[model samples]
Target: MSSGNPTVFRTLNERVALTLLLEHGGLTRAELEQHTGLSKASAAEVLRRLENSGLARKAGLKPGNAGPAAQMWQLDGSAALVAGVDLTTTSIEVSVADLTGRVLGVHTTDATGDVRRLLGETLDAAGFGLDELDQVVVGVPGVVEADGRRVRQAVQLSGWSGLDDLPENVRLENDVNLVAIRELQEHEDSSFVLFWVGGGVGAGVVLDGGLWRGVTGRGGEVGSVIVPDPVTNGRRYGQDGGPLGALLGAEPLAALAEAHGL
Candidate 1:
């Protein structure tokens, strides 16, 4: 039943187990076995790996019951820091978090045309240089390809074509996708869509606990969802600022209501 990547898979499972321990507090190995559905041996193996990686440690013995109390595992809370950057058309925010997802440092800056300089500078300001980064998740407001190289379009930023330079390890994901991922991480069973009605109208779909990255990675582009334009009586509006302006000003709603004789 091994997938040929037992080490890698078990390491990931150990991380999941550690997350469960953090959320529910310490649990016995039997409890972990039930929660993770791993065999007792696999669970023990992962626990050993977690302890070795310094991400988790064995806490003191749990009180009561039987001859010897089981040693509980707890999150180290400061292992392998991760940085998340939310880059928008006008603003940028950088946050540093430990392995436990605890925010350690945060900084914000106004975004210029180029974000590399801003990212480097803000990362330095946060005292978290690129070398210390275990992972950098960037939430961008645009359609990013699978390679994260070319951006189809960013609704908030006009004339923004694509990124000039992106690091190898940095993950560039759509803002709404990031939102969905964050939501799913917090509430795994919740099924919902994130509608971002800011500079433009767009949505990120979370169906059956995963993002639907379609053929072109443009599956959730709600702005491209063409419906009959009420003002023009079933005419299609191209992706532009006109519809957004009307939506913001309530003109579109009013026009639709008037057209409907309401």
Candidate 2:
């Protein structure tokens, strides 16, 4: 089925070609056509557009099985850059990567003062200016909204809020959700629950081969689960002092251990 729009079709073809090059590292026009099912002319046009846009470039030549060598095309790694920021109560960690997902640099700094300024400084330490970054992904300890535009709750980093004043391409995600993503990538299991026991308690759940963020993006907010107060054993604990935090969080655990003379 065709969209009946030439511009749309051309854009789709370019995207398909780019995807092939990114996944395989390099590909000839024939290989792109074979993998993407695009016509020879369509594939050539897509490649031309990608080249003109500085997203793809000719790498080298690949000897064909029966013919002369073919030109190998690949993604332009230096065309764009991305940064990942891990925001914690004590420090801010930043990692810069090129378009091909190669880590260019990594830096860490104290998490004091304005977050935007700290981000700029961290990027500078990574040998790139803030303006040079194409995108920024910020992982914060909180319940991020579905649209990733707001941070609803972050008990540890109380001074920080959403990425309102940052660049439009900056994304805010829950730190626990990021952990779940990393776990899913590293392990073979399709489903599991990751418990985060630190200054605050939280959880990330992967179900059916995907991170299960509930309808309101609160699926794995284990820290907010209310239970009987440890002191009174009658009333439910408040949101800040829930059962999970009281049992597994650092301060509470330390206090418990001290009380037992450990």
Candidate 3:
């Protein structure tokens, strides 16, 4: 006997089938039924809804052992576009990719202003529109707090009022942390630590195949460790040069290079 409404069950089944397609890339009706534990007719209905909704599309056919070729279905990669935004004190870069992680386009600009406005312009230059992005991950020079709802300690972005005005799909993350995530993607199932030196000094901690951001996402703030100031032989506190940041950050490095005429 039927317990819940058929429509709700149908929707749920469609979601399950879509998820399977996403995970496995492509699947035939029989394979979908085998993975989902759904009968033939139910699987067919789910596939039908997915096709009608444009969430899945036919991708040739799969050969079976005994029967004729079965129709293969896969998630439409173009159904959702993802954007990665990197905002620094001097530049804004936007990269667009498809659901399958294929980079569609990238645009970099020296302009700095409202994030949304810059995002729109960058997307346009990247051969896409702001409306096409289903998700946007922003990397800023700061520690993300409150599960990415807030960002702190981004002195380079002082002129920036934060991402509060951006849409919910736009998430804030630390710059070096984003680089760490990129490393994790390239080297899966590994534990490693990444140190980044730029306009600032920061680190990213990857532990047991995952990023171990501390309670407030400040786990990699190596720049604030209070290293001894070589110039003063004492604690350096003012002019933003007292912290470890001033000792090893980009400005100090540049000064060293200029002093040596390098």
For this target, which candidate reaches the highest lDDT against the unseen true structure?
3
Candidate 1: regions farther than 4 A off: 1-12, 39-41, 65-68, 158-162, 186-191, 228-262
Which ranking of candidates, highest TM-score first? 1, 2, 3
Per-residue lDDT for 180-223 in model 1, tens only?
A: 77788876766678877665567778777878778878877776
C-alpha local distance difference test of each model: 0.75, 0.82, 0.83
Compose the digit string of candidate 2's lDDT tens values, residues 113-230: 5778888888898898988889998998878877777777777786654355677767889888888898886675589999887667788999977988888788888776765545
What lDDT tens digits, residue by residue, belong to model 3 across residues 1-262?
Answer: 7598988888788888877887788999999999999999989888888888878889998888998999999988887899999899987999899876679999998977777888888889999987778888889888787467667667788766636777777788898988999889778889999999888888999998888988866888888786655554443564434667777866666765766688
RMSD of each: 4.2, 4.5, 5.5
List pairs with backbone clashes in candidate 2: none
Per-model tally of clashing residue pairs: 0, 0, 1
- Output the better candidate (2/3) by TM-score: 2
lDDT of 1 at 206: 79
Pairs that collide, model 3: 236-242
Candidate 2 residue spans exceeding 4 A from truth: 1-3, 159-163, 181-201, 204-212, 226-242, 250-262
